[model samples]
Each structure stands twice: as structure tokens, then as C-alpha cells.
Target: MTTYTAINLIARPTGGPIGPDLFEVVQKELPSVGEGQFLVKQNHMSLDPAMFGWMSPDTESYIPPVELGDVMRSSGIGEVVDSKHPDFQVGDRVMGMMGWTEYRLTNGVGLNKVTAPLPDEAILSVFALPGLTATQGLYSIGKPKKGETLVVSGAAGSVGSIVGQLAKADGLTVIGVVGSDEKADWIINELGFDGAVNYKSENLAEQLAELTPRGIDVYFENTGGPIQHHVFERMNAHGRIAVCGLIADYPKQTPDLAPNWIPIIKKRLTIQGFTMPDHFGEIPALLEKLTPYVMQGKIKHRAHVLNGLESAMTGLNLFFTGQNKGKLIVKI
Candidate 1:
């Protein structure tokens, strides 16, 4: 028998989650692969904004709430230590929906064998789910043109960072909406965004008016709530909106819009809600197109990695509180 550490969600969260309490780290025994399944030793576990929604006690959602006393749901990358599956082998690198467990067992329905080698961190930051997300959200919803304005909310975060770079490469004037000036400086100066507006700094509408006087054609919406409400008012006619995640309203109930989303209708926006797994067929395309840029560092990646499984909640809080710069990951 193989033994390992697994992080399990002990309870459903009513509101904002706190460290350790939201999850319980425990040592668990692992069984050998029965027949078709492969076993992996996890090295990197993703901390996604969607994880909070998945653990919500609320009944409304696309995914079922994490049942009480279950290993927390997450995506991870690891090396296969042992295998009974023919498709995988001993020491094959793979990416999949394996949760926080150090050792995973599954029939490999969702896992994809990562044909390419990852960086020193075991898996490339952009090669995992966040990388896939940027590709999906950008091309699927954002049709950025040579002379258009593209703005990414949560611009300093993983998906948003990728979104800006991809748009800039496509020849669009890019603006980023970030949480802090330090984040703003990094995204604008280091990452090559045309400009960035710190939501904490000034009026978004005013900034949009100054930077994108011609109006915004594409918006990669990662933060919803009041910011999105303001953005809708500044949106151009026939603009496309990729509704990614609403980190601002996470673990908190959103009240009904008093004016009833009037700006969305008036601007004739095309808003589509999305998740990466919902469209797995695009993975090959995403990897195919994104690989070249990543290899060359044309499309950059940033990840704030927390050591071990204990900081999962803390890392998530960094995201929720706007303290993080890019993709949040827990290195196990």
C-alpha cells in the first residue's frame, strides 16, 4: 500500500473562507491502481477562483457543491509514478482534474498526457488550467483587431495577464484594470500593456474614456460586480464580453441590480459565461497556438506559488483580497 497526504474540505463555506478551517490536511493511505487507472504523485495544485464557488453551500450553480468531508476539488499536474493504464506509463507527465491529494487514482477520463516537458516547477505555469483559460476566453469571446481597445479586469492575474499580452500581440491597444498601483506598474511596464488602471486609484469610466476614447471592443471580464457595472456603461456597440469569474462577489451574496443591467442591453453586448473543462476539445488548439509564444516568452506567465497544502486557503485569500499578481498555485 502507498501512503500520502491529502487536503480535504471539512465543511461548506457560508461566506469568505479562512485558512486551515476551510480545509483539513490529513494523511491518507492510497490503494494501487485496480486495472485501467493510473496513479500520480502531485507536485502542483491550482488555486482557482472557481474553487470557492464549487465549495459554496448555495444551491445555484453549473457544478454540484462539494459534499461535506470530501477532498477539495481542484486541478493539478504531476508525474505518474506507477500505472496500470496502457495510455500512460511509469514516469509520464500529465495534467488533469486531480484534486489536492498527493497521490491520485482515476481511470484517466479527464487527464491529458502532457507531451511537452514542463519548466523547473514540474509544470509550466501557462500549460496548466489558467493557460488553457486565457486561450479559451480570448479567442472564444475576444476578437481583438489591429486597431481596437482591449481591457482585462483582474489584469495582473494569470488569465488576465495572458489576455493582455495576446491582445497586444494581435495589435490591439490594451488596457488593464488591476487592484493596486504596484500591480498596475508590473502589468503596464513589465508585461507591455499599453496602460493599466488601478480600480483602487480612480474612476474606471474616466480612465476608459481617456485611454479608449474610441470605445472598447473586447473585454475579458474576470472581476464582476460594481466594476463590471461601470464597464458596461463604457462598452462600445456590438462589443464582446467573456464573463470569466466574478472574484469581487465571491462567498458573498450579490443583490439584484437596481437599474436591472440596463447598460448591458443598451450597449448590445455579447456576454458568455465560460469554464475551461466545459470546452476540452479546444485544448489541442490552445496548446498548439500558445506553445510557440510561451517557448519564446512572447506570451509570458506568472504564478504565485505557496509552499505545501497548508496555505491553500491563504493563497486563495490573496486572490480574493487582490494581494496576488498572477496564477495562484500550491506546491505540494
Candidate 2:
């Protein structure tokens, strides 16, 4: 009999910040695969900001919360260890919305077989939803142009980092607003953003104004609060703002401020909030375009992967604390 250790949500968080205590690691015996099911050794679980939302109970959300006593919902890379299905075979690598466990058995409906001939962890990161979220948010909401300025808050996180480079690739002068100097350096020096503003230290509004003299053409918003509100004040006429994820506001019971009507009406800007899941219909189209850049090493990636699936919660904690330099990934 095979058993696996998995993280389970013991209780839902009512309010305030979530803690590790809310979850428990439990050992569970795996049932033998049925006729059509396959089993895989899980690896590379995604630790996203949206996980925080999962902690809340039954909130109106993009995805439902994890019921108490349920295996924590997650997406991960898995290697087919055993199989009883024709579509999946032993030694195949796959990805899907799985659970936080060492091994998983499924009917292979949601699982997509990733060809190892391309790259080992390629499906784990770039070809995953994080990249999709970043790419889709910008192109769909932020119609950037050559020589225009694009401001990205939370600029060093998984989605934001990708947004910065892609915006730059679209010929926009990218200004990243990050939490740390190291994060700022990575975006500016490596990711090739035009400049970086360390929001933790800099005079944010003044810096944004000076940096974007002509005003910002697009704002890829990931943080909501005073900084985002301030960013609204310096928008170019007809600027586009894509509200993807709000890290600061998620932990709070309420939002920092109401929608900014002042700038939107005055600047004639378009502010749209979206989750990539809602835009999954266009993923194949987006991936097709992104592959060339990835292959050419133009739109490359950086992953801060931690071995062991149990570390997914830890990886997410590291991400929130700004310890993660790039996309935080957990390898089972």
C-alpha cells in the first residue's frame, strides 16, 4: 500500500492574515488506481497569491475556497509513476490542478502530458498560469505601445516580473515599482525594465511623476492601496490599467479605497480587473505567441524553486515576505 503526506486545511481563516497553524500535514493511504485512472509522483506546486483567498470561507471569488478537512487545492507538475490508462504511461510528465501531496491518482481529464523533449520544468513555470496571467492581463487590458510608459506595481513577483519584460518587449518604457532594492535591480538590470522604483523607500508619487514625464500609458496593477491610488493621479490621457491581483488588500476584510473615479473620468483611462482563468479560452493563442520569445531566449524566466511539496506554504510565505527573487515554485 502506498501512502502520501499532504497538507490539509483544518479550518478556514475568518479574518486578518493567515498562518501556518490553519493547516496540518497528514498521512493518507492511496487507493489503487481504477481501470481508467493513472498515478503520478507530484512535483512543482504553484504557490500563488490567490492561495490567500482560498483560506477564506465561501467568499465570492474567482475560485471556491477549500472546505475544511479537504486536501489543499493546488496545481503541480507530476511524473507518471504508475498508470492504468492508455493516454498516460509510466515516465510521462504531466500538469494539472492537483493537490498538495507526494502522489496523486486521477482519471487524467484535467492532466496535460508535457513532452520532456522541450524542457524539464518548462511546464512547471513559463507554460503555466502565472505566465498566462501576466501576458493576458497586459495585452487584454493594457494595450501598450512603442515608447509609451508602463508602470507595474508588485513588480518583482511572479506575474509582475513577467509583465515588466513583456511590456518592455512591446516597446514600452517599463518602470517597475518593487518592494526591495534587490528586486528593483533584478527587474532593471536583468529583466531589462527601463527603471525601477523601490516603493519601500522612494517617494513613490514624486518618483513616478519624474520618471514618467509624459505620464503613464499603461498601469499593470498588482498592489492596491495608497500606491495604486497615487499611480492613478499620474496617468496619461487614455491610459489602460489592468487590475490583476491585489496583494495588500487581500489580507484585509475590505479594500483600501473605492474605485478611483477622478482620474478615470478626467484622463479617460480604462481600468479593468480580471483573472486569467476567465480568459482561458485564449490561452492557446497566447502560448503560441509567447513560445517564440521563450525559444529565442528573449522572454526567458527565473524560478525560485524549493524541493518538497510540503514547502509550498513556506514558499508562499517567502514570496509574501519578498524573500523570493522570482517566481516561487515548490517541487514535490
Candidate 3:
């Protein structure tokens, strides 16, 4: 019998920092691969801000919560080590919702074969969910036009960084809202963003006003908090906002009150909230649109990797703390 390690959600979080107590690492024996199933050795697992929402008891979310005693749900990239499935071969490298485990047995339902020439980390970073989210949200919801002013919150992050770069490729003036001056510099100097505002600065609103003299035409919203209000007040008439995430409120039991909608009405803005799960069918097409940018060095990416599966619990907090520079992943 083959044995492997897995991380299980032992308890649901009660609206605060997630600690090691909430999870248990256990060794479990793998069941024999059934008729259509294959076995994969998970190489890299992604830790994302969305995990907090999945840990909550909220069933109304885009996806269901991870039930107690179940393997914590996560997206991972792995190579097929054994297979009885027709669609998958033994040596195929695949990516899918394989959870936080060293090994996974799947029937090949949602699994995607990885064929990109990039590294496993890059596959999980730019070509995976983050890249797809940025592409879909920017084009489908934000409706970016040439020469428009586009600003993205969490701009140094996986999704936000891609959004900024993609907007730049489309000839839009890109501005990034980040947590620190260092991150601001990375986006402005390295990622080719025209300007950046550090939300932690005392002059946040003033900085945004200066960077975006034309007013914000498209806002790729990631962390919704006071920074959201500052951007809201500077939006151009008929501006578009793609609400990608709310990392600011993820740890709170009760989120802050909704921002005033008066500006939304007065500005005649178009604001749409999206989750990547609903757009999975569009990935191939989105990748087709994004591959050139990445291959051509126009879209840059980075991954902050933790060494083992156990680090995932503590690493998730990096999203809220702004400690992670880009995509956060756990390498097993």
C-alpha cells in the first residue's frame, strides 16, 4: 500500500488569523486507482486569499466550505505517477483541484495537462488561475480601451500584477495601488506601470490624485477597504471596476459597512464582482490571449514559495500582511 501525507481541515476558522491548530497533517494510504482514475504526485500547491472564504462556514459563496476532517481544498500542479485513466498517461504533468496533499487520486474530470515550457511555479502563477482571472476581469468586466487610465489594487500580487501589465499592453495608462513603497517601485520601475500609490502612506488620496490626473477609467479592485473609497472618489464618469477580491475583510468576523454608492450612481459606473470558478470554461481562450504577453516578456510574474505542506497554514496570512511579493505557493 502506498502512503502519503495530507493536510486536513480539522476545524473551521472563527474570523481571525488562521493558525496551525485548525489543520492536521496525517499520513494516509492511497486507495487503488479505480477504472477511470489516475494517481498524481503533487509538486506545487497554491495558497491564495480565496482560501479564507472557503474556510468559513458560508455556503452561499461561489464554492462550498471545506468540511471538517476533509483534505483542505487547493489547486495544485503535479505529474501523473500511475494511471488507469484513458485521457491521462502515466508521465503527464497536470494541474487541477488536487488539494493540499503529496499525492492525489482523480478520475480526470477537471484536470488539465500542462504543456507550457515554463517551470512548475510559473505554470501555477501566470498560466494558472491568477493569469486567467486578470485576463477575464480586465477585458470582460473592465472593458479596457486604448489610452484609458487603469488602476489595480494589490498591484504587486499575482492577479493584480498581471492586470497592470495587460492593461499596459493594451496602451492604457497603468497605475498600481500597493501596500509599500517597495512594492510600488516594483510595479512602477520593473513592471512598467506609469505610477503607483502606497495605500499605507499618509498621502494616499493625494498620491492617487497626482498619479491619475485624468481620473481612473478602470479600477481592478482586489483589496476592498478604505483604499477603495479613495479610488471611488476619483473615478471618471462611466468608469468600470472589476471587483476581483477583498483581502482586507477576509480575516474579519464582520466586514466593514459597504462604501457609499452615491458615487457609483452619480458617476454612472459599472462595477462587477467576479470569481474565477464561474469562468473556468474561458481559460483556454484567456490563455491564448495571455500567452504572447508572458512569452514576449511583456507580462512578468513572481512566486513566493514555502518549503513544505505544513507551511500553507501560516503562509496564507501573507496575503493580508502584504508579506508575499507575488503568487504564494507551497512546494512539497
Candidate 4:
């Protein structure tokens, strides 16, 4: 093919709802692969909460903002259709930060070749950023212990779901806080979580208290909202918190109100915020650790797959609306 399609960030969002107008889908002539580069036909692209942070004018973040007119930054899995590099062969399946393009030309720098015995959706859901983030934050930051009570906010999401499952595997009591009863049921009944709290329920605090009677020893904070406040107040002394993502505050112009800090002091909480970029080097080790769980079905995942690259603009809104039940992916 002479040309391929790509989505480009055209403007910065103003803390309001995102729309297709901020992005432009354009067709461009395919570029030739350099002597050390290869061409990939991107099959699937991931839509994540971090995209909102990348779309904003916040260069002070862990990574730079997506520059205007650039292909909207994303991670994708694809097949190498053409190659001039010895490290990668034609027909090799790989994953990397390939952005929102139908085809990617790369020098094999950041790419990791994947041989998946599982479906593409599962690989993208559990073996990609979501799984790595969950593994790192929970084991590295949360420092989970056997029989400790653990609570996860945004518990139905890609990262949170994996966090709950991993914690459960380690013999910790797992409670997942989600937006709806259906999600609650999925986490508890399907994912084997000990308890699930619907954050939208009128008696959320009471429900959380009932589910975590032992007091939470590890809190995996994914969405910073009232659910976090409820969990924070119930933390045990010396409790650990892995602050992964604040999806609730991502699209807002003003920051959400801070949760009570008295508990942080009284409980001697250890809170740490992390981004996947800083931990990229650890992915190989993480994948080695996580792959066995996935193969054994000790870790499970779901994907809300959208049909085309253009769907990414709307798919991202699902993260904020709590509409997506699992990992969000755009199938190209």
C-alpha cells in the first residue's frame, strides 16, 4: 500500500469532555524502511487513562505532552511486514509504543518481539502495560503480605483488576471498588475477589467498612475520588498505598478535593505514585514473573475492543464515564 491512515492530536483539551474535533485522521504516503529499520502493520492499539495527561499542556508530568500534529501517542501490537534489520524478521509479532497509526516504521529500538500462545486481546490486556503496572505497583510499592487486607479503587479496570487478582493469589484478602453492581459481581464472582463495593452505592463507606473489617493493610489507589477517601480512613497502621493513576481527576480543570490526611499520619501510610515510563527497564523481569500466572489462569483479563483507529477518540472517554468494563483496545 502506498498510503496509510493515522490519528493526530490537533489541539489541547481544556479540562472538558474530549471530542473527535481535537484529533484529525489523515492519510500519508508510506515511508521506506531504513537499513536498520522494519515496517509493521499495527493490528491493535491500546487506549488508556494516561492519554488524557499526554493530551494536556502539562509538560511537567512524568512524560512530555503529545505535540500538536503528531500521531496520537499509544502502545500497539503488530506484525512486521517488511524488514531491513537483522534483529527482526518479516512476520515477527511485536509490541511497542507505535502510536495511532495503521503502519509503523521502526529501527527496533523499543520494540519487544512477542510469541503469544494466548489471544491478542489477552496479550494486550494482561501482558502489556496494565499487567506490568499492576505487578510493579502491588509487589514493589504496596509490599503486600500474606493475610493482609487489600483494597483497590477502579478495581474493574485493566490495572486494578490485575492488582486484585495478583493480591488474591498471594493470600491477601481482596476487596474491589467499582462503579456499578455488575462490575462488582464480575470482580467478586468471576475474578474470585473476596468482596466488591459499588462506589456509586449510597452506603459506600458502610459497605467498605463491612468488607474490610480487619482494616486495609494495602490500598491500590487507581481512581482518586470519594472511594479513596473511604478506603484511606480504614487503613491499618503502617499500611502501604500504591498510587497508580487518578482517573477521576484527569479530565477536570480543578483538582479534586484532597482526602483526609489525618489517617495518613495516624496510620503511618507509605504512599508512592508511579508511572510506567520510569519502570520500562523492569518490563522484561515483570513479564517473566507475570507470564506464568497468565498461562496458569491465575491472572484473568477482559478487553473492550473497538473496531477502528478512529474509535480511540471516543474510546478514551469511556475511561472517565466508567463505561468500559475492562481493558480498552482499538482493533485496526
Candidates ranked, most accurate by lDDT first: 3, 4, 1, 2
The local distance difference test score of model 4 is: 0.91
> Under the 3 Å rule for N, CA and C atoms, how many clashes does model 2 have?
0
Instruction: Give per-residue CA lDDT, model 2, range 138-218, as digits (tens).
Output: 887897788899999988877888788888887889999888888888888888988888877757878878888888889
Candidate 4 weakest lDDT stretch, 10 residues: 258-267
In the order shown, what is each candidate's alpha-carbon RMSD? 2.0, 1.8, 1.0, 1.0
Q: Which ten residues in a row have the lowest lDDT in candidate 3?
A: 250-259
User: What would the per-residue lDDT of candidate 3 be over residues 173-228, giving only the tens digit for each residue?
Assistant: 99998999899899998999999888888878888889889999999999988889
> Candidate 4: which pairs clash?
none
Off by over 4 Å in 3: none
lDDT of 1 by residue, 194-303 (tens): 98888876677777688888878998998875667666767798898898988877757654352246666787878888987687887888888878877777776677
Clashing pairs counted in every model: 0, 0, 0, 0
TM-score of 2: 0.94
